[model samples]
Target: MGRGGVPRPTGRGVGVLAAGVLVVLVGWLLQAPALVFAGTTLVVLIVAVTISLLFRTADVRVTRRFTPDRGVAGWSAVETVAVLPRGGRTSGTVRVREQLPFGRLSDAEAAAVLLVPGRASSAVFRHHDLPRGRHRIGPLHVDLVESYGVARRRVVASGVAEFVVVPEVVEVGLGRESRALGDGSRRQREHSLAGGEDDPVTREYRRGDPMRRVHWKATARHGELMVRQEEQHGLPSARVVIAVAAEGWPDARPTLPPTSRVGVRAATAAIPLVSDAFEWAVSFAATVAVEVGHAGSATVLTTPGGTLVARHDPDSTTMFLDDLADLRLDDAPGAPAPAPSPREPVVAVVSGLGRPDLDLLVASRAPGSSAVAVVVTAALPLGAGLTSRPTRPADGRARADDRVLAPDEVAGALRDSGWRVVETDSSVDVGRLITTSGVLDD
Candidate 1:
């Protein structure tokens, strides 16, 4: 039974009640006692059925739990719904429906399960092919139906859970180009400094020199004191700049306000092109961050809001992706404008770039620091699949005012401005795109 509501009669029950009245009228006209008695009995049966339906006790609750609440794209996750019925009264069937984040209710009959009254039951469903973002699941909908389907009580149990799907990471060797990024050389320096492999450098001994460090051969040859000196290792730090500024996008909605930070929510009806570009930027940023971390370099991330210092550890990487998952393009009218990026070697990820200042932002932050720019565009063929090396247009000229610029044009422009560049789209295999670009290597 449902609280604070009256039970309505089923269609069949209503028909039967009407037929009983008609039968009673016919009996009265014909002066027949048998028909009247039959009609009265039929009417009484209808009332009894209605009363049974109204009094039936059904206190059922449903809770949904998802296995591996967070996962990468393409992984399958299982959802288990536990049905608990109280009062030891189970005379009905429960049809369950879990809500999808996109405002669609899951299919009903497939999720339905019979209630065994006081005993609890569970049903399982699998979610697959989820995209990279934060998805909310749960708030199970249970429909209590009588054995004959004459009445139904709708129960909405509220317990919402969140599932975070992160970008997929594909393993690959960072080739010679990656070695040039200073990680390999840094390791060699570390080895030499530790004196585990390389011979210690010897020099004239000072008064404070340790006797163990004394070079007997040098001392005997020069007839003077000599001591071994350890070399210092200098590890190069890497900085990654990801351009998430909505205004920087060629197809960005001009009417939309500038966002104060990266995680600000966008409108539900954001333009499809803008949305696609945003996703590409985020995924590309995550992939690059991971690569830098794996390279044993200290990494810093610069986005539209500000800069975030990233690390190599699993927890740090997870948190970094979590921030990316929550990244959105908001309209901030009253917020202060974002500050210009400081000079640093940057792996700039943007939807588009044509401004000179934007070019300078991607150039070296200081001498000896290298920069790479990755342009994520939505103008590529949607279903043809991702391509890292986009071909130049026949004309080889790009309109500055176009809604989206060609990747080659962007690359050429950035190159002319003194930065290494790569072009890719959202659908491109992330691992291959960044690894083969030779950006991480520099």
Candidate 2:
């Protein structure tokens, strides 16, 4: 059990045995009366030794190797603990366990390792679940007994390392590697992104841009119709609000509509729903920064670096990603979703969009009237018969429906809600969708 307190070798048994043997031999040689007592004591000592040996737990040693570093929200960890048996009492089974804080990897169970007899014949328990901090692999404890129902013993060993998890990033999808960053603030970006505002010089005009602000002096020098091309704003970085589908998040309590009966809903409860490399979202965010230049919108990230408000710079992508790598996954109370403001659009990385809450969010961003663009990152997250616009409830009273909508159907629903939905084949292709899903005209 619990160490039974620390172990310190006791020499009492050995001393007693030695004394009994010595007394017996000396007394018998001297023909003394005490020889009888000595002989009896020797027998008792032998019995004691037999009893102790019978109960001693099989000699066991443990060696544990673990990945010292962890990503954000470290619910899954990799640790291999091997148990080796020493000479005496060869083999026995042991429990390989880790102390996990409550609420981490709720789905995981404790591992019971079976140890086989012989040297180096051990059991390795990989994929140990640990929290986001240092964990002590206390001394190895082994409880064994050779003679059944007779006696038992405990053996322990020490020397364990620590695993640290920083943060988990939820990368958003952005299209062009050039458009890695979404629109950022112009003024802030100029000062922060363009080498402290001294990097770019006024240059000539181009076809697509407004012309009245042309630089006549520069035109004289360059002998061309030059326009005042002030420093291009910093890279384009778009901040997004990410959420697991309301019903899909681990802690979600699905309040099924009374209208529809609750049945077994086939929900994919794994990361990277359609394809692997869910890291695609992160790649898109980086791309946006490259294409559009910063709009300087205040970023609100769900993951560590997921949110951003500053202007984009050469290092913006790196900074954003580094921050993203810092987030950890936890099912704390889901925070209230924020309303999209006028500054820029809001992109949401969600699991399922067929839910009613999703529609309201998109509807909030009035089509053709607001700058907000709602990008829903989900893989078949809706029920069937999804409606684009908020159709009047069948009863004529306003009520959201309980229906399943395909991803393409959701795209159309978004359009009906006054949003332009850019549907992608894979949620991983968030970049392509966001780049093309900008404000669409009627």
Candidate 3:
């Protein structure tokens, strides 16, 4: 390795150099003119090839460009690598190998390229079926090969790029069914505040404040600009609770019998049930958070470790999603935290209604608080080929057979406790499920 680049001798180049030395020694001992000439010519050719490859990769530059710098799960992103040689003309083939996201680059097409000086040579890496997480596509390895493929030089690209694979989000509307029962009473108070001129709430004028809201008497009394603060009336307030406890998640086991391969038993494969369930639950939580933001509700996102106040803005949404991107299932459930304000509706995403989870939901529920529990059970071993078809029990009854299905049991418990429950599997459309459940609509 040198300051410019690392030079590695190819198999053919090493063989040629060894043969040239052996032939030269033999010719010197035998005093043969023709053999000496042949030996010297071979050595010169090898030296020339090494020298050419050494400098070709020294000044080479590589830049990567991602078609939509960010991607989502199950979506395709294209990465284009641009190769340029700074000074001299590149004599041989330039291989641009890229580091791909989510192990998405299994094909050999990401490396095939020829470098043209003064003109950029580009190679495309198509990343498909990306998972929801942060992926780094960077530190390109560029290999410069001689025309005869004898000598090579390696150069690592300077920059490393990052791509965020966010969870899929669907816009959900807050339906009346999703609203808290206290919402009506709160609105009644807001209306009273709006009609009463003597209401005490007042604030300094803001940029978007209407002139009509300016109180001349208050302004004169305060000796500065003042405006009567209007009551909060944009949308019904809602809170989102996300529970990613490992305790509530079911362990994945092999669903099928082991088969023999070459007369030997193969290891049983298990579906990533717990991982899948957690991912689905996170995505569902993110969708609900977005809906709450859109409704202009006071958003409260509760995780196992802590709570985050999410506002209706791009930065807040990005920050929340970024947290979800790195979120994982905790080994044990955290201690009980402060619950959301009882005056607004609440949406909770739990693996299932285990004792702790049920207690938390019950504690958060007020007498008139409208609450929705989204139970994510796609990973549970309920049955074969389960779909997301929500069923209502007759006379608020739970079937005896549903005891095995923990999600169903949780749903029944919630329903009987006077809370709306939405059951979801991996195949369910989160956005559609929320909207169809009438949680986001009036």
Candidate 4:
């Protein structure tokens, strides 16, 4: 529950009621006639106690049901509240406040409603797009008031779960070809088959093969053991890795030098970009993964949509999106050694285009896995494709003067290491590039 939420009233409810009861009882007993005051006091005390006993409940359980469960960063996720009163039922005023995900701010649609005995009323809340990351909902506030608003009782609701606000997932074609050259092919060559992915052929079943796949017709015709053969599928059509090298990113000291501004801005914009980028990437990844099924890859084993992480897995997609939503400038993954594996696809999205360390990282990975570096600096060149976004700075050093790499340079470097580099024009919408690539648009 949020701050200023209604708190449960204890002494206020019984305290005022008891005091009035005592005063009346004494006045009746001490009066000369006695009967007049005594009769009135008895009636008042009985009524007060009766109402108190009726509303008294020790255990209250609060739960919420959310619709759709996941949505793009800009959309809303509606939820309903279920209130279960355990000890006893009461007819009185009930106030509730629900905590929203992340920095998401919320306003109540309806307020100050009465909760009748043994009945539960539902309320809906719309979550706005806050800064991206893994947002969680929790901390319900239950406030109970009695004795004509003289007092109130409050309790806290715990154990709320988290939801990820990812960039909208969109499709990016050719990403499979992009990734096939990296994470997938390496795993296949080491563990599965060794051939161009597009080749149309099937492999015989092995120890793990299911009886359902056994080719009875083939066995009958061949007079020997035979099983279904599966076709080979190509590499991932897309691979999206949002890399935030804190050291290579911005420290954001306004007093700092000109170069610092680039890092700060790029890093600061991570959630905004990541939120949208991953959302788009997931769909792109999944669409391509579907074809891999024909290629004999088990979901997760050989494809992004499969065992590794595919479109069919909402939970996995949610996880990837959430990680991006929560991303911030963390120190470089401890002075980046060789990546965990040669097949890992690393996409360096940074603010400073002139970072040499980042360039070295990309250059190093070119030999083992394809690498892509996206620079988002204002001083960097602009226009569509690399061929347009570069020029020599006043400093005039080819590699050092402030200049965004031309597409040719990027593509050349990536190709040299057997990777591919694609960039966006500053004039173009970054979101569009992400979406056209088949990532989320939201």
Q: Which candidate wins on lDDT?
A: 3
After superposition, the stretches of candidate 4 with alpha carbons farther than 4 Å from their true spots are: 1-58, 104-118, 146-154, 172-241, 247-328, 331-348, 353-356, 364-372, 378-431, 434-442
Report the candidate with higher lDDT, 2 versus 3: 3
Per-residue lDDT of model 4, residues 9-102, tens digit only = 3555456556656766666667744554655565565456544533454345566776656555556676667665543544455766665534
User: Given candidate 4, what's the lDDT at residue 319?
Assistant: 44
Runs of candidate 3 with Cα error greater than 4 angstroms are: 1-56, 84-93, 104-107, 111-120, 150-154, 172-236, 251-274, 304-306, 309-316, 331-339, 352-354, 379-409
Kindly list the per-residue Cα lDDT of model 1 for residues 1-442, writing each as its tens digit.
Answer: 2342345556676787889999999999999999999999888877776666555555667666778767776677788888787667564566777666533544443477777877778878777765666877766666655556555545555567788877665565562236545453466457557753334466787643336446677677789976655421122445566565454453443222232123435543443223556656666666766666566443556553444423332225767777566655543223332233333346777655435335445443556557778877664454632223222334986444433234556677778877777767667777778766877666
- lDDT (10s digit) by residue, model 3, range 306-351: 4442333222677667656665555334444445554567777775
lDDT by residue for model 2 over 1-442, one digit each (tens)? 2242222213454455677778878888898867858676765855564456534454456666655445234346566667666555465554344433212222134344555666554434444333223244444445443232223344444445444543333343222232212334444545556454333356656543334334566667789876444433222223354433322231223222222333545332322121111234333443444333333333344322222222334334444444444332333434543443443444544333444545554544423333233333334345622233333444876444654343455555556765545444334444445545652111
**At residue 375, what lDDT does model 3 achieve?**
76
Backbone clash count, each prediction separately: 4, 55, 8, 48
Candidate order by lDDT, decreasing, is 3, 1, 4, 2
Model 4, CA-based lDDT: 0.43
Clashing pairs in 1: 177-441, 178-441, 343-365, 344-365
What lDDT does model 2 reach? 0.42
Off by over 4 Å in 2: 1-68, 72-125, 128-177, 180-189, 192-237, 248-298, 302-343, 354-356, 363-409, 422-442
Q: What lDDT does each candidate get?
A: 0.59, 0.42, 0.63, 0.43
Best to worst by TM-score, what's the order? 1, 3, 4, 2
